[model samples]
Target: MRYLEVTVPKGRRRAVLDVLDDEGIDYVVSDETSGRGFAAVVRFPLPTRAVEPVLDRLNRAGISDDTRVVVIDAETVISQEFDDLLDQHSHGGTKGSRTSRQVLRTKAEELTPAFPIYVTMLLISAVVATAGLLADSPAVVVGSMVIAPLIGPALAANVGIVTGDDGLTSTGFTYQATGLAIVVGASIGLAVLARLAGLEPAGVDIVVVAELQERVSPNVLSLAVALGAGVAGILSLTRGFSEAIVGVMIAAALIPPAAAVGITVAWGMYGAAIGAAVLVIVNVLSINFAALTTLWIAGYRPQGLFEVSPTRKPTYAYATIFGVALLVLAAPLVGVTLVEFQATQLKSAADEEVDAVLAEPEYNHLEVESTEVLLDDDYPLRSVDRVVVTVSSSDPGPMPALTDHLHEGITTHADGPVVVEVRFVVAEDREGDASEQIVHTSSGDRDS
Candidate 1:
């Protein structure tokens, strides 16, 4: 429910009162003592869903487009007429339960913050994320996401489009593009500084660090995160869910991948950098597409009759562009997913072949120890390059036949040519290897 305070302009008082009366609303009108253009102040309580309809009625009654009106949440209403009003609006079901466009726009603007603060905060977050990635700390990385002011622009653009607010639409896109650039730039700057200071270390492979690797080689699961964040973002905006919690989720999709772009750039890993950059772009497009589709389908549009056609046509065109671009960018992710599946399959087949070879009676004395898999260094798109198997034997004699047998078996199921190596370790029998001592019992040599 809402409580609206309307400033009824002089000579429009009767029209405004009549508009309220025809709708069976209960209002209290008091004279405006101030010598302003307004003659009286009218306050009325309404169900949340009825706000738009009543405002539209006021607009149609010759109230100027610039008329001042304020709508706020109503905690309690004690009128019999208010019960009837709530019942009247409840018939439309859940769709009518969403916050009005005006409230949504206001909330989005509030979330965005001033321009300078937005850029500064994002730069700080990027630096923190880059440091976290280098240090290989998951908790610190998540801390970076918590402080990101990203959700505002993520959802604001869609709200602007659906509500016919051009200013908001422009600001939302501008902020998103500019803010992302800022974060990525900050990460690069910090990473470059770290590298120059020798903090990257002489023997470290920074790009393949556990934390950084997650973003550089994104797959289908990455796309799913962005889409989910977007859906949750818009739903929170319209339905009063916590935007702060969802902001972290949205940042999770964008922040680390952006940081990956910087870390790779600093390390001169352009191949991996391109992969990470592509992931960031795909996630952004997916988020925007999801939010726009959900908002439009939820019946969010300009309430004015004349504004709907002009707004929706371009709005839908942009939506289509987002959809099409997502399809184009996401094609690579699908390819990456297939490669990953192939790699997993190859590993499984290699293990199976290793077991089959040692199962032979000639090699029965050898105990298989461990198998290691080495994959190619192709960014995002990777394939198995080599497999190493180690075995223990009581005899020291070399066996050249085992390597050939294992290679032939694995290569049959492999998608590409691969190298196989076998290493032998000699293990002599030793006494008292077990931790506990055993003694023969009187009955049947039972352990004591």
Candidate 2:
């Protein structure tokens, strides 16, 4: 149950009271109170189900402007007469009541924070994400998600656009863009500092840590995750559910990828950085698009009829822009996916070929340890698979023959031209009284 205290102009009090009476709502009206400007106060108790309808009626009756309506939660209403009244209204279910537009507007306004808090949270989230990526810790990454403030402005952007509030739209966009910039820039600065301190992941190769790698190569699947998060986020907001879980979902699509971009940029891996940057862009657009669609379906619209027609053109334009961007982003993702698939196939074939070659009588003592198909940087566009085989052998005599046979087998089974390289480790058997022991030592790579 909700207790509403409404103050309206003195002349309109009777009309408002009549509407309340028609709705079967019990109320008490106090007229011309004190220093107020000819105002009357009408206090009423209403069932949750009737709140939206009552408010809508009052709004249409011109009681919304300047008139004050404050809703207070009724903990306990005890009276024999009121109990009967409540029982009569209880037949209509109150679950999932639609929130008033005024409430939603207030919510949007509250979420649009002052600049300092927004930038601070963005920087903190970015630093946390960077540290998580460096440590390859998912827990730390999720911690970052929990603190991320990006989802607010993202949803706000959708809300503003849908409501045709230019000020809200501009504020949302400005905050969102500024937050993203701070996150990326701060992450890059941290990465540079880490590198300068020799704290970066050891080696010149691109940081292939689990967190970084996962975000650096986003595909169609990533977009889907972002879109789903966006929908879930708006649903949570409108339903008055916990926003924390939904915030995590949005952060999952956003934070790590942005961190990846910064880390890659700091490391000077521009190609990988491009992929990470694309992932961030795709996720942001996908979230906004999904939220906009969800809000529209949820019956959210601009304030006035005049505003409705004007909103449509900009809505379509934004939707089209997002659609085209998604299509363009998919192109590189598709290429990356195809290349990865081909690499997997080539690796499998190479493994089988190496096993067969090592199974030969002359190379019987050799054991295949591992096989990997890596992209040859020299001919990346051509999709040349470099088959690297690591083998342990007791005899060195058959190594040459083994390499040739492995190369022949791999070249035949692989889809494209494959460059076969064999790495040999000599295993020496030592005779012992207690037990037989073997020692393996690397002899280095032998190209075939």
Candidate 3:
């Protein structure tokens, strides 16, 4: 049972009303023009499950994309006469479902566990994240995820906004932000301490192996997983489906990567840290958006009505904040797409150059060590300085065709001068011999 006072364009009022009417919603129309839009005061009894569809319909009907929907508290409504109106339309299958979505939202907000739980979860996550990184154990990482309390606040934040309850919104934000900061801060602190103590984990163990595999730009698929997790989180909270959130827990596994970011930073790898931090932001924003959408669709509203018009200053402030947050989250997603595109192009170019250079019939097993676009520290006109290439092999025989092929292929592909560095490792028993294999070596001057 949510009371909504919405303002839509005068042109779309009839269409909007007809949609509402078709859904069996009882609403009153008030004709009041404010600033740039017409205002309509609509009172309705709607189930939480039905809110999303209504919002989508309104959006399709060209209701101001910026249309303001404020929830009115029906608890203080002087009209006891509306009791029968509410009873007839109540949802019967779900016992608690019939309660006002606003009421449910308020209840959820007040359901914040004690501070002790926060502390406990923080320490547990830190320890688990650390052990996972050291031992390279996915099972330990999952165990840490299972004990994490992050799900509560993530779901709460979305519910708070959709329901238009300031208390819920603020509480949700506070809890999630606090938990995130604590976990990240602690992980960073611990990793840095470990490095100072010369306790850095080394080599490609299970944990380190996982870390190396995804050392690149995140894709749209990551965003989709986050969004799905958010939706699952909301369902778990509302429908008392606690087990459902476990899947959400795994889908948007936030802790391990965040801890990995900290570890990378401690190891002085700023690039990896940047990528990991972007991943964190991506997951957080996607989850929040998905959760907020779910709550709005559930028909949650703030209890209580304002006889006085809602303040313009605060309303616009919220819109501005929302717009900025959306942009901040969206900017990284766009950047990820661009980065992925660049990586694809760069890889293709590298492969073409390598293939053209190694045109010999017998020479094979060419591996590229690294590809970087050299940049001048000062000048804007600094183009790609040169292309660097490294090659390794067990076969020792010198081949003139392979060398000549590389020279011609690189010159054709690169915009600037291309420099190639080739190395041949002379090993007779390259078979099962794991003794010593020189994978890569960089030369300052290719001619050397």
Candidate 4:
């Protein structure tokens, strides 16, 4: 069966439709008015490709003037099963690659995931995400990602679009939007309470920030990751590949960023919170865009038993959505690039200082370790801390001047006068390695 929807100017709709009726075309009509013109939609399902000749006939009849017709593939006819499948898909059914019809048929035949399970999954996700942020454990964070029930509303929005099921779509988005709001709200509240009770937020570290910072760069990589995960998600939905989809969920990293934003806000880290918020937006936009695009490309359409008019309005609506999504996906990348350029400049300054210090004659075996780069000003020693000049050979002689020079050089190089503590170890010292050396100072050194 084939479905064809045509849009005609209001003035010629009645005449064009009459010609279609006389030709024995079965179709339905809908009238939508734009600024100054009316769109008459005519839909019909025919077994054969009989639309082209009819359109040619309409052109000869002068009805084709200011009219456009498009043919879209509707895989299966509408049925009770189809309606139910759309509901399930839109309302957080399992990740599967089933054609929209297959999904419904399977739902009809199999045990569906119950509402209780859905709620449980949601709670589990929220709890896990919370714990992951507090613990600063990437493993825990990824686990939270795997368990997030956030996909429900996003999928519902897509299903709603394809099937033109407004209620299901709106309900789905509402649930998601509300759930996210609640989760983020509770997290911020918890953080505020903790601060009020004189509790410190978790350790601020790069790894933790990496897990939490989503909105920083909505770049090509983010889009690719979301798209890849979306395919896996759809495949899991259609093919029962739950385990793979779970990993995809983790890689996609949807929930942690929002939780991070809440925690950051509680800690009074506005910049971090902003970054986290960006991450949440990027993930949401990327996931929805990728998922819907994949579904549409795979030929999932609304399963209404009745045919409706095909108008530019629906197509334009989709285009607009895509345009917005594209912009969202592009944001993070731009932000990241700007940030990286700034970081490179800072690192260049620090590196030049390190090289100058290394050139000093006293320290022959200078080694610099600075794998970490600090992003936040609140934590002073982020990526900038340096360990220079490890003892490479045995030295029986005291080298006070050399040690002082190293300290002085570092202080000058870094621009800001950082507190410097020096320690010494004999090159062949067996018990105390350079890392665990004892410091000898006139005013007693501090090392704990």
Best candidate (score: TM-score): 1
Best by lDDT: 1
* Predicted candidate 1 versus true structure: per-residue lDDT over 70-125, tens digit per residue: 98888899999998888878865543557777788898898888999999899989
Lowest lDDT 10-residue stretch of candidate 1: 436-445
Task: Please give the TM-score that candidate 2 achieves against the real structure.
Answer: 0.83
Instruction: Name the 10 consecutive residues with the lowest summed lDDT in model 2.
Output: 433-442
lDDT by residue (1-448, candidate 3, tens digit) is 4466678676787888988877666567877656576646555645444554565566667664477776543443334434543444445643243334534564465555566887687677866776676556778776777777777677666555555556666877787767766766777788778777777557312123554324223545666677778777776666656633544373335776677667766666666566667777767766776676665565444432341134323434544564467567656556556544554565467667776555545655654445443322111112344444555565555444555555555555555454543444444564754222322212222243
Tell me each candidate's TM-score.
0.90, 0.83, 0.61, 0.55
67-144: candidate 2 lDDT, tens digit per residue: 788886687766665565566656564345445455656566776667898888888999999998887889999999
Which stretches of model 2 miss by more than 4 angstroms? 1-3, 32-38, 45-53, 72-94, 304-307, 351-364, 376-384, 397-401, 412-415, 430-448
Q: Estimate the Cα RMSD of every predicted model relative to the unseen true structure.
A: 8.2, 5.0, 11.9, 12.1
TM-score comparison, 2 vs 3, better candidate: 2
Off by over 4 Å in 4: 1-120, 192-220, 238-240, 243-252, 303-312, 325-329, 341-365, 369-373, 378-448
Q: Tens-digit lDDT track for model 4 on 279-392? A: 566666666666667656655554322422342246347647856866864665665655455556545654565466657775666444441224434221123333333333
Say which prediction, candidate 1 or candidate 4, comes out ahead on TM-score. Answer: 1
